[model samples]
Target chain A: MSADQEQRTIRCLVAKVGLDGHDRGAHVISRAFRDAGFEVIYSGLHRAPEEIVQATVQEDVDVLGISILSGAHDTLVPEIIDGLEEYDAFEDTLILVGGIIPDDDEAELKELGVSEVFGPGASMEQMVEYVRENVPEKE
Target chain B: MSDLIDELLAGKHRALARVITKIEDRRSGHRDLVSQLHQHTGNADVIGVTGSPGSGKSTLVDKMAATYRDRGLTVGVIAIDPSSPFTGGAVLGDRIRMGSNIGDMDVFFRSMSARGSLGGLSTATTDAVKALDAFGKDKIIIETVGAGQNEIDIVKTADTVMVLVPPGSGDDVQMLKAGILEIGDIFVVNKADLDGANRTVQELREMLDYSDGAILQSSGHHGAGSMEGTDGLQIEAESEGWDPEIIETIAQRGEGVDEVLDTLDSHATYLDDSGERERQARTRYAEEIRTLVREDVNDLMAEELDHRGGMDAYLDDVVTRETDPYTVADELVGPLADCVRDRRKE
Candidate 1:
């Protein structure tokens, strides 16, 4: 979040990572995030490790939301977090992953430092509020 | 050389890149730039590449462009990356795969975001192609915007539309959505090095066997399987590269691109001899754009009527059974017309 948004609220970056090209869910959720008043930067489909990180840095976003349905979550998710950490966005940006997961990968994904994994039919309003409540209120 | 046009016409790579940015941003001066460049079009052969996600579209387009450049043809590529439906911005990552061609003087490749367009293209894509067209490229290849079947809109703009089916996908049969199938002039089964390459070809042949259109199947990965899908829709057995006319190769290796190019030229000639090419292009936007404009105007009227608690009140009245939606809409249209008339009176 920039100082302007942080003065009152939070800013978020939502991206589609890896080859998971299903974007309708990501797009709708990002719009929900935006309507919730969080400044949202959505990186369109097929983002590489470096590209997502560059967007996170440039946007100064407070939260990172990733939507992947390509079954490449295990490979792409960790690499993106690592890139965020390298870019110093890890501590500042809260990471969220949403997509069609088999339910078995949820625990491992969270253990690898993802904050939340909302699955299919997840509530967009709840996700918006979840981000709002989680990001610390700045002085 | 209206800055970008001058650069594009001069065959400058960066200028083409920057103009794509301007057009994507919907900047003010773009209309004039494209208007001037319009005269430069009709020279390049437009090829569209589209397929399922992770189908290696960017890599294939990169290799194809390089191959065209090698053939002493100036290449123009419009790589359509998907855009964030929420924020309306694109990742434009084809540059990662197309490393050298980014700045090649002879090859101009521009990566564009689909910009919330459901149809695998931006509103500016046709104009962008026109810009590249006017730049005098002999061949222009458009990579699909990673949106799968919806990206079929490329058929309206491209001279030869290549429907890429990656090997082992098992999803190739699903790509025959009404819009996409009719548009494909040639079919490329990319990633041929994979195990299910032959099976995929067989499945596609079987599916297209009874269909009316022409179909060709070639691998874009390793140079293998040149069998044309139109030959036998149902291949009982996979024979040697018997026809040699169909098997093309190695999008990753840029192998057999010459063959792909030759096929595209032949197909274009066929379309010309049959006279289906211009007939299609003329009515391309007429039917589609007519409905699109009506939709926009309907949406405009809706927004205009919703400004002052009008929608909420109408809904409340309808919910209360005091008024049907048709009556409310009728009541609203009169005021809406008056509002428009009053504005005109101003």
Candidate 2:
């Protein structure tokens, strides 16, 4: 994986997983990522676990960012991570989560293979940098 | 729209209900479905109804819902009950009084607990509304568990907000929370069947007078003949044991729902037809976006800062009075606020 390969168009798919419909941030992030030159595909409100995994595979995304505000993150995120692992996309895709996460759950999410867990108030600058620096590029 | 959404868009009842349920379910892969729905939204009107617990909002909401249903319109209802602190979700579906229209297959009612959300709505209520909006419900009604004035959060997402006030709830102090008055698109003197309905109406009228004469009154219960119009139309007639024509109803009995519906239509029409309505709607949309953005950004920062022990540092600073929350906000994203506002205007 190299920068030349990285420029193979950093494709990112932003999805609001589970019952959360508060997509203002998701929409904002999509535009920001688009502005930063990634091919962005946004999955809007009320998405299920399987739909997200299928979209991640179908889109062939380098990173999958899921936003959950429904307060069911503890149960929901694991389902997606486990599902992705089961589907074999878990290793290839960088999973990031944002929104109303309780303070106690960060280590658990990270242990579950989530690349980054962002809470509210993080700058778009930080987000773009984190994703760009971490996600692997094709050979 | 996708095939499933196409079916929902064409007014398939089962599809509509199922998709909304998916939108509200925490484990469902609701993202793609929502993405599909986003393309099909903007067809429905969202009306938010909220008030105090004893204000008879659900009943009034029920009546209002029925009125819309009878006119051959599809209705989507989201009922928010108080969440017990222990469980962090709605423990009771006590809003069963509004069942008159809930029985209709065309009417979809989903109940939720507030789940410690300070603003009176559960975390998922807005998402549920979006689900209803995407499902092509002609009208969406949100019945909140009346957290007094603070319940105004519903106004953040709704096009029109109806505030319910029951009779004999005490003076003006008891009728509304201090700052909550501004959130109401219209005011109702609900439970017109109770004593002192006139006094309550009078108090509301007095409050409205201060605002250049802008509030309307109605009974808050659902079913037949529940809310009759007062003779003055501008003020209560004061000779009321539930004015049969003006406001009459046993919500459980389903009386006077037709008139309440008529009042809602008239108010909505008034709002939509006015220049202020257009301006207000646009402002509301912007606010909705801002609230979501603010919360999302806040949560992200809170988590990151916590991980870095920044919050602990901030707490230490605050204890020593070195930095307040305002100072912290200014220090962190203060410089970026202007840019966000500018972008929002765009």
Candidate 3:
């Protein structure tokens, strides 16, 4: 990598929102991002939407991966987006949701500012490539 | 001053975060930014908390920050996790354990990756502390990447370095006898609710007693705590007279946190009374200057090597024994040495 490219390394945050105690998937994706040469920050399980958004802003991550398994994506994801909007971070941040996201709810989530949704069995490589290509350039 | 520094000094959390990111990434102008921040520092109490993984360093730091907030003292926390050496990437999960400061901008928690630094702290950690100090934080806590014996770098960054030992780890206590034991200002026996808590504390006390004289002498380098130089005979007494303190706590329950806070305050006072703070600052500034000069010279040498057609150009000659590695090094460094020598003669 060029010096400039190395300095501008992509930073990603893997977050678990709400009362989802299952974190094996979150851990898996966090490791995947790390192996992809992205600095990954994992917000452990049972985080509130506001808490996750707060961390996102503080970390200034290029990608925010919200891993939800509790089927509360409809309520929790929007609140997180709203929190990011409050800080004007929603636009600059590429938001990705993973884990048990239904096809019916995927469209609504993308409409609500989520960049993409990866259901079960979505290849980690595909998600990694998607983030590498889609992360927004910093000013 | 740049707008970012201006905003940071004006107490904007976003600016502080951006400043730290710039420092961590080593972006252009970060050196200049840190130079500007130097004048605004020395007000905050910098503390370092480090221990082995699962020793509850984060839990204790969270409680410490929350307690400081309750006392109306603004706080900043920098938690570090190691990066993957192979990939140059890291998964920093320290924020997960630091839930108390969430949504409270006053705490200003940031997670940093070690980024291939062998010392268990990112190279930018000192500069990040400067950013927080310039932002007017009252207490700045640095939580190091938890690699037990290699955390001596924490001494350079913090006034008080607390090493936490999980209860029932008799082996862990012995491990401290290597290097971590030398730099610790306060030894915390965390998870005091565990079965072997008392035994752990006893072991720590015994160990501290055994190392009493050695601690006073060797601690002069980094100013671990009190250990006032014994009269004029001992040159090592740059700090106040402080024997390391041992405290036990169940960090998960906030047990014994008040004592930790009190010990921190007492250490700070001791630093002031003994005039060790100024001495420590002088030593740190000297080290920082040396480090910057060394890094800059290294970069210059790399550029010079490239100008001389790089190392590959000399490879064939060295392989055939027509020229040796030392000769090549001397040839590369010769011009710089000549320049210095000529300047001295002039």
Candidate 4:
């Protein structure tokens, strides 16, 4: 690929926010992004809501994937939205959540500004395509 | 473009981040961004921290950055991890250890993967450092993946390098003896709470002493007249009139790390007073120019090859022994020579 095409590549940050220590999904998705020719930043495990927002903004990631398996999705997802709002990044950034989120909490999460939620058995290809389709084109 | 450059120089955080992404991706216009921002750099002191795996290098960097932050200095950290060769993926875990400083606006932390680079850093690491430098960071710490003899390229770009020696890792001592000693401006005995902490310190001090003693012993006996047979040992020449210091630290506990920062400050002062700062700057600039020239040549070669069928034809010739590889290389170089001259004219 041309260097210019490589530079215009999508940038994604896969994060584990709040007390959710489980990161197998985060790792799998992050590697998928990179293998799919995107620049992926894995923020490791056990990140706070503010830290997630700060990392997302500073890294200028087009898509922010929060993997929370701790069942605190309702509490933590809102905090992440508030963080994005506080930083005035909500309009520009696309948010996605992946974890063992209960089916009942899915609608509220989307209501809380999460664009999509991938529960158990979500395929890597599906998530990758979702992000690729969602983020806006580069200027 | 100039407006974006102006925003970046004015410390627009988002602009700085965008430029870094562009550079890291090797995107078009990255050269313009770098060339324009180049003059705005040199204000930030770049420090490199490298050690072996499980050497507590990340923790040390975290503590040292906190120390700099306490002194009201803005810190930018670039922590690198090796890419998975099989998967082209990496889990850059340094930011996890440095989670405590996540909320601090003064601190900007980015995790990087080596991206198949043989060296201990990404190809864009220095450019990223330049971005951070232009963003007004007072200090930029590049924490490289714990590397061995061949991956010390961080030494070339850093104003001062801190080589961490974890206690109880006897192999690190041996590695230092092999060649890593030359790159260090400061030696840190990390995890001092562990056993062999004192022993590690003693071993490092002994290594430094022996090397220094050997140089002097040879110089005195030969009256500084002969450059041959200095105990059959060739020491990497360092800046004259400066001694590398050794500090002991337990980074996880936040113990003894302040002294490491203090020693780094002293090293910076030494570089300024001894004129080594200018020398280091010149070395980095020269390296950047050489790399750009090489890239330009590669671009011309690629264009020529694409126009002439492709690599398959050349490889088919080599495979069938129809033509020699050297001849093919010469044919390729024949077109590149003029293109290089034209580039110089431009």
Candidate 5:
């Protein structure tokens, strides 16, 4: 990485959408991002797609990590993506999905614009490295 | 840069966010950006809410923002969280409690980290407030990183400062007697639905009454009284005769939020009527100037050290007792002092 890129702090937003009160995974990932020297904003549980998108745009974060174990990623992730596109935030934000996902749905989610998905037992190091490699360069 | 400012002034949320980023990072030309924003400020009523951890500051602020929005006022919120002193990273979770204003574009909420600021607020916070103010937000709320006695810098930013006290913590009330009591324009007993809420309120009221009497007695004596205000701004506000209000709130259920809003409105009127607002602004501007100059001089001193073959060159001499720290400081600053003296003579 260039010196400038290394110096620029990556801002990430880890959000739990749609009534999934189970936030242990979200808290763990947020800590992981902080340890990796990135500023992470955790959107507390039971957020709507529109709320997540609004936060993403207003925060101007580099990465959007949506943690959903409620098995509703198919319905919610697309709406989040659509909201981001509507606000012109999709192009700059690299989206990552964590929690349960069927293999078929994972591919379709990626087709919609998710950069990566982490299933259960994914290493913290792996998620951090993926973000370092994939986050879009800030202008 | 001008284009970015134009976009921000045109009420674009993305541009405002980007400008705030520039301010937070201290990117080149940020000072210029903020300077240009000065003319557009002074319109928004800035309210600062601070308390201890889990004191329901976020929940109360969320409800307050929603209340203001319901009243047809545009709102902007800047919630501060502490940065990890080791890694300079932060997990800002204040947005979670702010679910009330979620899909509303009129209510803009952004989170900030302390970024190694010991005062619990970095200079970026003041500048970010300016950015939001310049963007035409009617009400701007600054939620501090849970405050301790020394973390009273919120007084320098907000028009009216509200300190939240959780119910049943008599020790918490005593803790406030140190620094926060003098700065708070209003004290809120949040989580009023909890046990011992009434007792907490009574303790707070007693404390405020004691402080009020102390301030009144001190002002009358001018310089002879023990409770003479340490902060000039506080003295000005006290002399204006605006007593701090203590109110109870159940923030989680949005109860007592309207009363909080009413208190804020009355405080605003008091500031305007008493001319304390103008006095506070003057003091704030003076402090801002001093802070900026201090930072610039520190940067220059660092560069001067580097130019003198780094601190190692001086360190060895000091370590061997060949030169004392005072002597080294004098040697390093001598040239700059002489240059300034020479300019005065010219």
Candidate 6:
């Protein structure tokens, strides 16, 4: 592993994608990540998929979490994955989805290479443990 | 030199980024890393940009950094974002505005949480800047979270400071009047396309006129809070004047960026011509050294107290008010004073 990959600090980007004006979950999870001693960059509301990809790559975050409570997860999440690929960052970046994701859509999201899907009322502790357990080592 | 330092000196981006992370985390051995990086710094220009939250400071920084990059200068940006004390998470959205420079080999950007600090910067900001400096970035831009009285510490570290005021934000400058006026070397009326840009500029000019000879001193290179030698002091800014030029800009469209860069270059020239460059360098070194010594001494005293089991007694005395906090401090300070004297004798 490269020295950066061996780094113990887990850097994450917590973003609200789509027209989801609801950001309570994003705020909660972002704070939870930080309280867990992870370095987190909370991207403010209404960020486009391209902006999210750009932030993930530029900030060198280990995880890209999309909080879509507007029920537009399928479309926005795929676009974000595409944006990451367009930026040549898909392979190195881990994708995560949160907020209002239905049970049926979880498998599809995983097929789209999302590492995990978080539905409503999920605890911050579970999310924190998941990120710590799953964040990929840097190249 | 160790392998990581060698990689950093050879301009490896990953190594430089790792060093910055280490310093920000205060990881084990980070102090040694900072000390090693210190010798390799002093090449990059450190510029600080501060403004209220909605003043478009991020977009302004994006344009400024791009302007430098177009001149073939490598840029490293340290964007500070305030952390939520309750949750400890921060919305570091500066990268969203600076998207244009992403994926460029010549640009490096990192967003740091202020870590619950109200001071507008992370404590490790200076060390992170040094890591970038040692990594061969010609320009380092530090974009503060937002401006406030406590945020003036940026002036102590940056060579030039640009304070931004957005249009329609009336009384914004008035709120931070003295601290901002005394510290800013260049005042920018950002979002100049808005309705109140001219008004903001007028207010800033009025404040400048009202306070004459608050002119940046020769050794006042870093502005107010500078402890540097002021040998060739100019009484009036108009005499050896740098009027703290108020430039208007629509940063989103990249308008007036050249003028901003030009102002920065002129300030660089002024520092050199006024012989403030060497003096500012000395001042920065002394400040860093003194801060380090103070922290080291405090840490050593704590360790000594911990070792001798005196910490509990000290706390009990203060808690019971059996002795005042100051008196307890006085009792503990003797060991530290002796430690310093012994080191000097050695």
- Cα RMSD to native, each candidate? 12.4, 16.1, 5.6, 6.4, 6.0, 7.5
Tens-place lDDT per residue, model 6, A1-139, is 0111112457788988767799888888876787786777877788777667666655667788888988888888888888777655677677889877777898899998999888876788888888878888653
Ranking by TM-score: 5, 3, 4, 6, 1, 2
Off by over 4 Å in 1: A1-139, B1-15, B28-40, B86-90, B100-102, B117-122, B145-149, B171-180, B213-248, B287-292, B295-303, B306-313, B322-346
Residues B201-319, model 6: lDDT tens digits: 66666667566645423432323212122311232244564557677888999987887887788788787888878888898888777766666666666777777786777778779
Tens digit of lDDT per residue, candidate 1, span B211-287? Answer: 54335435343233554333322231243211212333557876556667777776666667667677766676574
lDDT of each: 0.64, 0.63, 0.81, 0.75, 0.83, 0.74
Docking band of candidate 6: incorrect
The DockQ values of the predictions, listed in order, are 0.03, 0.02, 0.47, 0.40, 0.45, 0.22
RMSD of 2: 16.1
lDDT per residue for candidate 4 within A37-66, as digits (tens), equals: 666877887888888887876777888888
Per-residue alpha-carbon lDDT of model 2 for B34-93, expressed as tens digits? 667666666677878776777777777777677777788988777765543442322223
lDDT of 1 by residue, A44-63 (tens): 66777666665555344567
Candidate number with the higher lDDT (2 or 4):
4
Better of 2 and 6 by TM-score: 6
For candidate 3, write residues B204-236 as lDDT tens digits.
Answer: 666665676544233323232222322212322
Candidate 6 overall lDDT versus native: 0.74
Estimated TM-score for each candidate: 0.58, 0.56, 0.88, 0.85, 0.89, 0.77
User: Which regions in candidate 4 have their CA more than 4 angstroms from the true location?
Assistant: A1-11, A20-46, A69-72, A85-88, A100-105, A132-136, B117-123, B148-150, B171-173, B176-178, B213-239, B319-322, B336-346
- In candidate 1, clashing pairs total 8
> How far in Å is the alpha carbon of B121 misplaced in model 4?
5.3
lDDT of 4 at B1: 76
Candidate 5: stretches off by over 4 Å: A1-7, A19-22, B117-120, B171-173, B214-240
Chain B TM, per prediction: 0.74, 0.72, 0.88, 0.86, 0.89, 0.86
Cα error, residue B12 of model 3, in Å, equals 1.9
- Candidate with better TM-score, 3 vs 4: 3
Candidate 3 C-alpha lDDT tens digits along A8-97: 668998999999899999999989999988999988879988898889888888899999999999999999999888876788899999
Q: Write the per-residue lDDT of candidate 4 for residues B1-346, one digit (tens) a residue.
A: 7777898888766677777777766767877898888788889999999888888888888887888888999999887777666555555667778855878867888876665533314347888999999889999999885565434775557899988888867754575554767788887877887888777766666677576654423233322112122311123234365666667778898887766786788788888987989988888788877766666667777888988998899999999999988999899997667677999998
